[model samples]
Target: MIRMMTAAALAATFPLAAAAQVAPTATVAEGTLLDVVAEGRVNRVPDIAVIRAGVVSQGATAAEALSANARQMASVLTALKGAGIADRDIQTATISLSPQYRYAENQPPVITGYQASNSVSVKFRDIARSGTILDTLVKQGANQIDGPSLTIDAVDSAMDEARVDAVKRARERAALYARALGMRVDRILMVSEGSDGGAPGPVPQMMVRAEAKDSTQIAPGEQQVSANVRVRFLLK
Candidate 1:
């Protein structure tokens, strides 16, 4: 005769087997990792203008050349001050006195005279008045000039905005990838920032019309600040 086993008896006889069957099996599956890079940019009007103003003078001797350069540079400094430029904003960039050499076909090079140069980097907080200041510098003996590099004086806010945009774009891209691969985005595992294009650099110099009848005009177009980011996401 066969005897039917009750539930309690089955549990007692095969305790481990019964526990395995009823144990929770809803564990989250391992997700596929993905990495994506994205870039974001912000455009804004520049607030400041940087320009290099310099004087070059030549004389028969080094002392004379330096003296002439000093006189001219003094006038340039005075002009800058008259235009309301702060003393801290004017920084000496270059000061040099080199011997002028005359190259000969057969004989050795001869020192004909000396050339001296003095330059300062000037930062103009007022973009609208920078051109007028530049013209005044020219009239005051600043012959060698370069750059009116337009840039935002305070870029921290703009950079932050760009960074946020970069993260947003990265997330969107990651979601798109997850959808394409028939999966859903689980979470972001890691995030890292890359290059920041908002940092200022040496901008190429443009032509300055100092001799024009009207005052010099400076047009600061929109400047772009960019940020790059790399994100790692888990998709399941």
Candidate 2:
């Protein structure tokens, strides 16, 4: 969203905080200025994929459940490594062991069994084969799967492009306003930028059969990087 900070009069209808910081006053003979808040957006295709894959096991005893979970989780990790996933790109996300209980109508709940779960978060630099890798992890005893948040690894360049666009747009807006008022843009008084944008969060996963007929399909759409800037220009 973009906004125009014209004068104290413009602030009469806007929030006090925003109005208070409206176009700053400058000591000049003309005493005319325009402040514009502009946003710049740049879109780039995502180059990486992140996912969470895990194993859950159950047994009559805690030791049994833990051992079973460990064995299955080991296979899952090995599968990721076999698919060229580096150790640095993989990290443990969760690990838990809890006793299962049976609810009885007439008495206290009884302990039935134990459950063990272990999960890992993984980053795939190769988005093309992410789906196939996901399926392979499932076959390797990963029963719980989540995410595939697509993102760009290095965002500085994209952000820089966006910032440039914002400044350009702000200048254009100021010029338009000056033309309408029969005045000309004289000089830039200030240029300030806002904070960075948010990254995509984790997405839910649908359960698929471990034994699939073919390699899974993955589609990584474009991601957007945005920047915001506030500019104050002197008008003559």
Candidate 3:
């Protein structure tokens, strides 16, 4: 009989499995999900300046090219030291020696000469004198200059301030939503945090010639730091 088979199947199952199916579920009116976005901004003053600059030289032989590059890099390092840069703050970024080539329509490329390059990274504490230091580098033999990325030396306090702003904004938004629905905020259910590291703006490329008369004029403008937060609260 159908009833007999059903009873037999039930008897074969474990007691825990049968109990799990009959367990009581929480009883409450289902609530709707409301997503809110809150943004906080903080204006930070930069404390350190990082710059990349280098020397380029050409010679008939690889050794000669490297020797020339070394001499020019030495002079550049000396200029940085004179400008109050410490050895720990200055580092050689790259060094390379390669043969230059001349190409023809039907003939194989011919080695015309050898070129050597040595690049260095410099960090400066005094940002106001950055332009003058760049001028000094060019005068001493730096042919390529990459960037002067401005950044804050420490971010703990700034980040904390930003977090406070974000939380305040989130609370304001939640209150507005609750009031619209004819209710008051009861308790915060959850909070989620997000962050972004600000990227530096564009830097233009320039070729400095030894015969140039004026120092390179640089303008380091203000940078923006942004934060976002999400908060969930119960409605009373």
Candidate 4:
């Protein structure tokens, strides 16, 4: 959710200027100033999936481990491309080679073997194929799978809606306050927008891996986007 926030300092910052509206000699204009803060939130169905997949291989030597990991990772990348994943949508996330050690009670740790891992982050624009693609990746030797985080690729429209709602709420609150004080809103003095969640609210379902035989159910749950705004109204 996006919300608008303001502190008493805001009004204090321009105390002299605001007081000038009433009279040069007036000490305060409490009845003539109205401020309100409000927040708006909107929900939308996610249309994109972010999948992090990788391959881990172990061997007796560092080179052997790296070589095996490379072979598996290559197959995974090839499978992703064959499934229509573009190069730009795929990014190398991590690559590492670590030595395995055996712990002994009466002796120092001994080097046992070497393990190599490589991971990539893949963005699936087409939600329908997200599950199928993931399944294919696993079959193609992706042993280290992390997430299928869901999100909406384009959030401009949803963000606009939230902003509109926030503005509406702020105006309503200002009007209510003015009416309670036996005054009417003359005009909007200032309006400030607040920060938003940017991306979707939550990672709805963080998928680790798909079940065997059954198709992966990539459920892109409804995402909530919020906006907040603060408004200062000139009352008469």
The C-alpha stretches of model 1 lying farther than 4 A from their native spots are 1-28, 101-110, 199-205, 208-210
| Alpha carbon lDDT of each predicted model | 0.77, 0.80, 0.71, 0.76
lDDT tens digits, residue span 1-236, model 2: 43444433343322223312344366444536577788888888788888889999999999999999999999999999999999999999999999999997998999999999999999999988888888988888999988778888878888889888888999999899888878888888667776657345344355567777777666776777887787777777
TM-score on alpha carbons, each prediction: 0.76, 0.86, 0.79, 0.83
Model 1 Cα lDDT, one tens digit per residue, 19-49: 1122213432455666677888888888888
**Distance (Å) between predicted and true CA of 64, model 1?**
2.4
Q: Top TM-score: which candidate number? A: 2
Candidates 1 and 3 compared by TM-score, better number: 3
Question: Candidates ranked by lDDT, best first?
Answer: 2, 1, 4, 3
| Order by TM-score, highest first | 2, 4, 3, 1
- Name the candidate, 3 or 4, with the larger lDDT value: 4
Residue pairs of candidate 4 with colliding backbone atoms: 1-226, 2-226, 2-227, 2-228, 3-227, 3-228, 4-228, 4-229
Q: Number of the top candidate by lDDT? A: 2
Minimum summed lDDT over a 10-residue window in model 2 is located at: 11-20
